[model samples]
Target: MAKEIERKFLVRSDEWRTRAVSSAKLMQAYITVNEDRNVRVRLIDGTSARLTIKVGKSAMVRDEFEYEIPVQDAEELTSSAIGIVIEKVRHRVPIAGKTFEIDVYEGFYSGLVVAEVELESEEDHFERPSWLGEEVTGDRRYSNMMLATNDLASELIHGVSHQAL
Candidate 1:
């Protein structure tokens, strides 16, 4: 199993932009947006079909298996995916002797910036780059999977509502 252990954080400033290489813009939308549907057809590195269920706040139960579906069938399945859309560009930069990915969102999440660092293990250690701000790992609100399903404008509204209250 390929374990994807990583830490997320808020970018302190835009200085990291100087180190950016290029960015890939993408917009992915889930079919339903707020449901817990777990069936997914992921085209990562290679083509694969799998079913994953959220196990916890930051964990998922994934089972990748063989697939024999045709392209049309595959598209149909993916089209039914709950609002899993993410529209953004990923900025790659080297920081602290390691590569950090900064995601600049667009569309509904136009002003949000998130950074992530992948690790070999959950216990991995690393230097904190000056540009990295507070760690947001385990913060549900910062999770891209959640953001894909949420209304970006609603988040801003609630943020201001909290201050007013």
Candidate 2:
């Protein structure tokens, strides 16, 4: 069992773009979603795929089980997904000796950008980049699961302007 601990923040500026070391285009879909657990399949760069099962209620910590699978299998899973597929470009940025993943959303939720940094434990400490905006770590509305399951973009940020950079 892998314990996933991470902090999430909204992107305030594009400064992180200059520091991005690598990036990947990802498409993900939720196969099953419950209050405490969820199953997700993600395709990376249209070349690789992974199936992840996460269980827990904590906003910053969860039991995660991920396995690589054939791209074809993941593609098939999308048809059975509970909601719309999510599309984004995730950039890896190294800052203050830690790596952060900046996800710039696409498709239905285009222009939405968020950054996340994985930590070793809930008590771990890290630096917050200037490009990072408000910390949305515990905000359920900023969660991928909620964003995928919910239909109203207005609920996330009124008027959908948050969808723009």
Candidate 3:
């Protein structure tokens, strides 16, 4: 199992765009979810796909099992997903040596943008970009799982974000 460790943040402005080196459209959905784990499938740029199983309860670390699956299989899984299929364009920006994947959501979750930096360990150092707003690493509300499964419109309609962080 891969030990996944990362931190999440809200994007404050468009400054990160100037630094982004690459971007890819992503379509992902969950097949199963629980307090401790989730099974998900992702279609990247509609050409490749991956099935991922994330286990563990730590806020910054998890046991991640990921596999490359046929796009057809991924499409089948997505068709029967438990909630809304997540649509986003992931922008990769290298800041101070660490690459941050900034996810700009579309569809029902439009207007939401988040940046994540994967780390080798929970205590590893990562430089925060000026465009980074607030750290939302442990906040479940900003989680992709919650965004897919919850009725967030009511919670977020007051403004651009419920976690407008």
TM-score for each model: 0.66, 0.94, 0.93
Best-performing candidate as measured by TM-score:
2
lDDT of 2 by residue, 1-165 (tens): 899999999887788888999999999999999999999999999999999999999999999999999999999998788877888999999998899999998887777888999998888899887888889999988888888888746565454354325
For model 1, the local distance difference test gives 0.59
Clashing pairs in 3: none
Clashes of 2: 0
Q: Global lDDT for candidate 2?
A: 0.88
lDDT of 3: 0.87
Show the lowest summed lDDT stretch of 10 residues, model 2.
156-165
> Candidate 3 on 1-41: residue-level lDDT in tens?
68999999888788888888999999999999999999999
Q: Order of candidates by lDDT, top first?
A: 2, 3, 1
Q: Which stretches of candidate 3 lie above 4 Å from their native place?
A: 161-165
lDDT, each prediction: 0.59, 0.88, 0.87
Better of 2 and 3 by TM-score: 2
Candidate 2 runs further than 4 Å off: 157-165
